[model samples]
Target: MSKIGNDHLTETRDHLINEIDSLSESQLNWKSNLESWSIAQVCHHLVLVEESTIKAIAWGVKAGEPTQSERKKVEQHILDRTKKIIAPKIVEPDTKLFEMQQIKDLLNDSRIKLHSLLSTVEDKSMLAKKSVKHPALGELRLDQWIEQIYLHEQRHIEQIKEIRSLYEELTEAFSSDHIQ
Candidate 1:
């Protein structure tokens, strides 16, 4: 496993935790509009994606044949908020409201599973030789898939920030009305 990939994953997860650590249940579950997701939902989605990605990576490493495919530079593309990507049904967050601690625990558990799986790989270099099919990104090397997990999380961290901003704005507006 590459130290860079591990560092990116750790950094992104830490940032995500800091972003939502102080949020109340209402703040975590509050959506700016009916069509948007709350902070909790965003974290739930990240958990789902990471879990699925772990399975994919495991399968690719064990059963997949080695390929010399060129790696796609998709980090910047994943971080771009200009393009809105719809979540697939499998990865969609349910309507159940999640507590902040529950969301944090879920994220940490998923991270542990991913790291554990990576550590068990017999050959670290196989990560770059094996390929997996990403829904939109086409064939990605196993290592790239690992990187994609954090890149995807970083993207949603931005979304969570936006949700928090909107939540604060609405709360301030409501408070102002009550004060009047």
Candidate 2:
């Protein structure tokens, strides 16, 4: 892995684990801003990326994007999905209201699958070839795609921190047991 990819994966994973560990049930549901995603929603979103990427890697290995026809087919699906929801963040909450385990289970499974692919991905060429069709950035190589995922996680990790801090502040202000 490149320094950037390694750092992002490590840091983002740590932050995500730490943030989730710190959350109370109440805090998980607390909305930081009117337009913001709750912690559960954020978890849901991140898992979707994990799940998608795992599938992508599998496809990349099997089909090995050697043709433009294949790339465009996959690209269209990505484009449609992206157009529907620019980023995973803005997607609506699960109709089940985050009580669903689909996201979590998918995340867990995807993590395993993704790491398996990464471990065996001897083809460094995939990182440089335009394989992923990101809606916002158009087309990107595997390396670039990985970086974007890192950046996306980094962005949300910060959001998680901010939401937790804000939630703490608001609670402290209104908390009845003013120990001070």
Best by TM-score: 1
* Candidate 1 ranges with C-alpha deviation above 4 Å: none
Tell me the tens digit of each residue's lDDT in model 2 across 1-180.
Answer: 476676767677666767676566677777866677787777777777766665654565566554332323333443242343456443335523454344446556656666677788786565555365655555555665566555666566666777888888889887856765
**Residues 1-180, candidate 1, lDDT per residue (tens digit)?**
888888999999999999998999999998877888888999999999999899999899887469877889878778888988888888999778998879989999999999899889989999989998887678888898989899999999988888898889888999999999
What lDDT does each candidate get? 0.89, 0.61
> Candidate 1, 101: how far from true, in Å?
1.4
The RMSD of every model to the true structure, in order and in angstroms, is 1.0, 6.5
In model 1, pairs of residues that clash are none
How well does each candidate superpose onto the true structure, as a TM-score? 0.96, 0.69
Worst 10 residues of 1 by lDDT: 61-70
